[model samples]
Target: MNEWLIGLPEDQAVFVARVAIAFVVCLGAVIGSFLNVCIYRIPIGQSIGKPRSHCPSCGRMIPWYLNVPVLSWLILRGRCANCKAPISVRYPIIETLTAMLFLMVFQMWGNPAIFGLVRLQEPLLIPVYWAFAATIVVNSAIDIDHGILLDRFSLGAMPIALALSGFFPGMHGESVWTQGLIDSAVGLVGGFAGLWIIGLIGSLVFRKEAMGFGDVKWMGLFGALFGWQACVFILICASLLGAVAGLVLLLSRKAALCSAIPFGPYLGASALIWLFWGPRLLDWYVSLIVPAAL
Candidate 1:
């Protein structure tokens, strides 16, 4: 696959790659628009599909023209065309974020295999990673808004993750189904227990609930997908992120010392970092330290 691209003239290859990326961006934004629907409707128990997009203020059904992802929001000036109600800027932001994330995934997995001169690897991971990215966005947004992680997204994803690992053993850096399943199961148990113990210690130290059970389950889902090393990386990275965020909040006087902050979003962010650069970052750090030790 990549050989064809490599054989093309450099100018033509660049044009072809740009065209492919542009298409991916458009598709991502469209999917993101649907994700916005999922984020809004899931919490309220509304059917995301049956009811067409509508203005919440005036109950006006949005036409196709008014529903074209980020562009429509800009054209309408962040207001509903019918009632002139102020629309949240979050719509465009979500669309943009999804578009960018999708592009990154394409660059990471699709570029070498389909667009560039590099060797082709697993092309199937492109769609898998996209789905993973969307899941993170939806669940993170819901957690930010509701302060609760839905079991449907967290615990519900565990079996699916395990199944994927078994089917695509390459996900776990293995070629055999049994080894992949074993690694996934180990990570799952490690993720759950690791967070549970940390939560216990935090409660003891803070004399209050310091972690939500939802976060534990969320970590388990990631573990099932990525394996034990990723679980450890996510745990460390998320804790640092949470600590930094908590410090900023405290300094700004926006929250009390004991106020509860949702942790799922941090976990989601950490999962993404792991997906993109965790292994490389870990290797870099190890190299620095190992040389010094020796």
Candidate 2:
């Protein structure tokens, strides 16, 4: 599919590639804009679709021209035009982060089979990873804000992920849907069960709910998209992150025994890490463990 692109003049190819990359980045920021809507409305049971963007401080409807992704926030000087209330920097941050993550996914997985050549297969898979990252962003923010993961996004991602795994060969490491579904199913079940066991043990030992049920479902969604190996990586990474952050909070005396921290953000951050480094890390782990197994 990309043979022609490969054959193009070097200068022409560079130009085309740059243009395409810009498009992808722009799309990502736009999606991030919608994600901000999701982050805010999903927790409050508000409809993201019906209401136009408005100021939380003052309920004036934001004009469409003033709602342009990252630019609007900067243009408004980080304040609401109507109420003069300060806007949260997280809005632009989310949009920028989404755009950056989108670019990273494209650069990493873009034209995976043919490193430098642009192809149809590459662009298709970019969104799969981006959506994965975006989910983490939204879910993490919600968890941090509310101390509970919302079922709406996490639960909704499951079917979407499975459908992609079943049909999109490019998304599968195997590059085939049959194997993709099998791998995805394994990851889904394994992730759900693994966390369930941990949660169960924690609850029994602590005489309290150690982990939220919402987190279990969230991991299941992640498992379906990236498979069991990635899920495992995410768990390991999240654990380390949680431990470090928890210790820091304890040392600073900012966190108390009864004070609860949201685990979802750590999990999401770990997933982001794994998204970029999972395959290489998995290979390294196998190399270390394979000799013992043999």
Candidate 3:
């Protein structure tokens, strides 16, 4: 990477890197705009594209000038241009969140070779991770709004994840396509079965459906993208998160004891945590325990 930059002046290099980063952030915001459409339309069985963006209250088509992701929302003052009806703040929040997540992933995994921004690693992984993050965000948002996780987002992503793993063996930290595919398959089966078993046992103990089948499938998707090892770690993390959230809700009297709460967001959040720092944290935890156990 240094050799490639030898002929380039330092200031030019810095400018180019900054531009590339900005481009990715903007790209992510644009994708997030589409994701908002997916979140609203997918569950409702509406076509995401055909009608174009419009004010739901006034039924006025949104002009492209007014459709820019975060900027447009701010410019519009969070209201419909025609109706003056207040729009949900979620739009800009999702767009900004996606943009920030994209920048973080780029800092962690991006290669300047793709666009001459950062040191070369695997540039392809950048877009793959970006798309994965976007999907997770859409799923989390929808689950929060609807209390359901769509099979299309969970089960639908499995095959694509497997294909990506096979093509980019680095996805599974493997050198060979076969190994990557095998790892993904193992993760899919393990996560699905593990969660299903747990849900079954919970139902037996609680005398009701203890977990949504949607979550079981979503875990499979998680396994497909990550691996079986991640499945265990993420399950633990998500469980802890869910417990804390449920406890808070109960104490606040916002939700009754044993009331159903959306678990998909916790799962998605834990997966993102794993993407950012799970392996490092896991290694640290093991290092602390090993000598003590010995």
Candidate 4:
């Protein structure tokens, strides 16, 4: 075994790492499957946890074997067992995507070193990041389908993000607790206020409700987790991406100029990018533009 892997305390056994990774992957897949329920139900004002997983066509409760995430869909040939109604491909897709994302998080953060270090163990930041990503995935899908982000998701996400920010070590080796708290406070305020201001301006100019409250709340949640600087990056990146998407849709005759496009997905995408690569991307951009501007 490599020194890094073997150096972990006996209590934090190497076998535990494997188990942890497997648990996270399975949990993510299961959560993703549940998220599909949220996506379909939240839009239509249905309770997500109630009535159980059932076919919309025949209202038949899904059996345990048939509800086994990705495998079940394939086994049933993507049709409801009772009604033979063709199931939407979304279930397997969400499950697969979540499983992949969970695996990625495990690969990134499951180092024995992390578990062995007492300081690193306290705040549990990795799971927080996972939750953030999962929230983004769920909210983005909901927004795309309903043209609105649900309050349930956004409201639920913000405090978790804040808690994660407070727990995670600060950037540049600063005091983890203090800096994380400061960052979380600043990020929450900046994210909410900044977006709110823009939304006000947009509403005034357009003479209607411009930015959805959901977008603003989502940004605030992103800010709380990622800090103010990352929130700014998220805002800029999401806007640019949204504009590009809008332009593409327009050119393709898919969306009219006056049509409303939900901004939550772009924000979610930008936040994810920032989560993994914010500083590196910022540095690259600065290096590229600074010399030219100078």
Worst 10 residues of 2 by lDDT: 111-120
Which is the leading candidate under lDDT?
Answer: 1
**Residue-pair clashes per candidate, as listed?**
0, 0, 0, 0
Tens digit of per-residue lDDT, candidate 1, span 1-294 = 567877888888888888999999999999999999999999999998978998899999999988999999999899999889999999999999999999988897776735452323376778988988999999999988888888998788899889889898878889999999999999899999999999999999999988999999999999999998999999999989988988898888976742555889899999999998877888898999999999
List, residue by residue over 109-179, the lDDT tens digit for candidate 4.
44544344322232345676677678778888888787888777777867766666566645322466778
Q: Quick one: ranking by TM-score, best first?
A: 1, 3, 2, 4
Residue-level lDDT for 161 in candidate 2:
80
- Model 2 residue 282 CA deviation in Å: 1.4
Q: Rank by lDDT, highest first.
A: 1, 3, 2, 4
TM-score of 4: 0.82
Once superposed on the true structure, which residue ranges of model 1 sit more than 4 Å away at CA? 113-121, 256-260
Count clashing pairs, candidate 3.
Answer: 0
Task: For residues 209-265, write the lDDT of model 2, one tens digit per residue.
Answer: 988999898888778878877777888898898888888888988776325667888
lDDT of 3 at 253: 89
lDDT of each: 0.88, 0.82, 0.87, 0.78
Residue 49 lDDT, candidate 2, scale 0-100: 96
Clash count in backbone of candidate 4:
0
